[model samples]
Target: MDRDAVRLTVMKHDEPWAGAATTTGRNGSVPHQVGAPGALAESLFLVPTRHLVALRDVLRSGEDPEGVAVELGAAAATEGIGWSELLRDVEDVCRSVSGSLPPYEVVRAMSIAWTETAIHDAYETSCEDPLTGLASAAHLRSRLDDAYRLAERSGVSASETAAFVVVEIAAGSGPDVGLLRSLSMLVLADAMRTCFDGDETIARVGEHRAVALVRRSDAIRGYRALRDLLERAVDLPPLRVWVEGLPATSDAATRLLGELGRGASATELG
Candidate 1:
């Protein structure tokens, strides 16, 4: 296709192009080029606005055509947007730009990119707590299983110990206290992240309770650090904290979770 006609079509559709100008076609028409003269022109396709923007950013960042296509696919999947047409457009663009890169390599990259995005989306939805924005109970269970497997493989100790700490806030009868309780939950969550180096699995399993799983070696220290941090927050309501240590096994973790749930409604801290 004529370069000028292709450029005009892309411009009309508001697709992104490289910022360089190549040769003007016949009759004094300036043809905007991407990467090379006929690179983006060969595609002559339109993608979703967000995907287009992401593609432009990736291109401008100077990624190779295959890498750019991978990022484009990933960006589309992350935004829950379709990318079949977008991938075709990108493959066309890449083929036009580079003759050396194999078609199979491009397809593989795109597949890997979208698959990773799907896995990430699943992890976020299934293993993340919506309320406190921490790892969910399911995630904690999975981590415990991994810890046990690791311990067994290393043969260092069959009875690897871990701690499960639960933090509960008292709900006042008035709306003002309810607001205070909500704010305190956020503050306490922040404190847990800071005290634990943001590595522990903390989850809000109930309206008034949050739980954290930590290595037994650091559990008492983490608990002390959290207590000090919470003490500084004078405006927060009374808190109740329960700490328990157990072998890092599936049954032990389940029992600890059950105990934490049952005692989450205990008397408030003085």
Candidate 2:
């Protein structure tokens, strides 16, 4: 099939696949294991959009497919999908392009890429992500604690006054997808900074994830502006934005935060 046809075929399934991916199980996302019959594409659709684009490119150009494979690996890591599952997706995608699939070596490339990025993220050893200059996860937690305390003193429910603005930005697809994600985060940080225009503790909680702690009163206006600005953004996949109310207690809020960064959908959070 031609490139346009390939992309269209993949995109045709987006609506139903999105519904399935967002459906939750014991965890907050698509299950790590193979699910029910005909579930391969359901899981594949949850992988980053760029990964699918790269795979399409691999079949079209037949150049440095390993690079595409490794990117798929990184995307899987970010999406919390497993290696075996990704391989299955690759095989499934093969059936799309005249039974031509990238060899198993592509899967090996993915494993290596995932491991290297994981190790780098593991030993980050900073209060801010060096890549995006957003507050560290630890710092975000501390800020949450402080917010809860201030709410306690103000005699209003924290849920009434404060909420989280979570934005899931889909970056442009490319061979250097890691860089694409980082670059998009930079754009997102600027947009959040401009829209919130306050002491919002904006954080890059996970790959493709960002959150800002903002006053609920301001959130309605801020979210409107944020969506406008991001919608005008060039070269990005669709952005997902929502203002989640603070959970009942600080501990519960923290637990929710743990899931937020890992690409949990709004349905799961609710």
Candidate 3:
């Protein structure tokens, strides 16, 4: 059989939040209608019989379908698609047409895709500071907790090796000073990237206070880099910076930050 123009058409069921029906095409041609809507008001999609047969054969051949589903689910999740619900619907369609349960992997993939999509969406819309364009204090604290948990699960010594550093900028209050502070944050963020790995989390916790979580080994280097960056920028007004090291734990970090706000001395970096 000539297999050049086969395609799958997926139609979404009508619901309050459901988007307009979309079609997936192959051979650069629009999909043909399959049949009328089912009794459950589910839209009918026309999938190439050859593709379905191939997928069934692949499952029968002992391929790990669930794992494949998971990989695909993660990709779909990144795209903000509901993988699990879509998977259930696909299973229903497959059962109706093929008269057999869709492979477990197929169902699993959809579930994973849905889960991933939700997680990515939440992270993308998380609270962040406007001036520095970094995570907010609350969001940073939550991220710190998550990092700690992952490290614990992986048996890594992040708690002992990680360091939290606070960078407080002291600038005079004035219209010009406000503009200078904003510009300084941009420079500070760039300098921080040079001092720490790309994955380090930096956030503005207060008007003049920024915090960074980095490896203890890199804390001194990061501080010195930041100090140099601020000192060398002669165009900006003289801003006093006090860098301090705190415990990596969320509670301890928060407490130390509070103390720092109450006039803690600057930590001398070697």
Judging by TM-score against the true structure, name the best candidate. Answer: 2
Q: Can you tell me which runs of candidate 3 are displaced by over 4 Å?
A: 1-125, 150-159, 240-243, 258-270
Top-scoring candidate (lDDT): 2
Taken over the whole model, the C-alpha lDDT of each candidate is 0.59, 0.69, 0.54
Q: What does each candidate score in C-alpha RMSD? A: 20.9, 17.0, 20.9
Q: Can you write out model 3's per-residue Cα lDDT over 1-270, one digit (the tens) per residue?
A: 111212111112111113324365433222222344421113333333233333444555656566555554555455443544445445654554456667665776656655867665665466776556777666777777776677667876445556665666665787688787788777766665566556778876656667777766676666666666666665554544433444545566556545544545443221
**Clash-forming residue pairs, model 3:** 65-105, 66-105, 69-109, 77-117, 83-110, 83-114, 84-110
lDDT score for residue 28 of model 3? 26
| Tens-place lDDT digits, model 1, residues 1-270 | 111111000001104345654453333323335556444543333333434444444545655547655876686567564556556666555544453333565567777888889776775568776556777666777776776676778874324455566667876677577677678878888888888775777876555678777776776677667776776877777775555544435575565555454553332210
Tell me the spans in candidate 2 whose CA falls farther than 4 Å from its real position: 1-125, 171-174
The count of backbone overlaps in candidate 1 is 0
lDDT of 2 by residue, 1-270 (tens): 011111000001102244333445423344322443433344434565447556756766767778888888887676666667666677765555446565777767988987776656553445787777788777888889999888889886666678887788664567988877878889998888888777988887878988888887777677777878887888776678777778757888788788887777676666
Positional deviation of 215 in candidate 1, in angstroms?
1.5
> Positional deviation of 38 in candidate 2, in angstroms?
58
User: Which residue pairs in candidate 1 collide?
Assistant: none
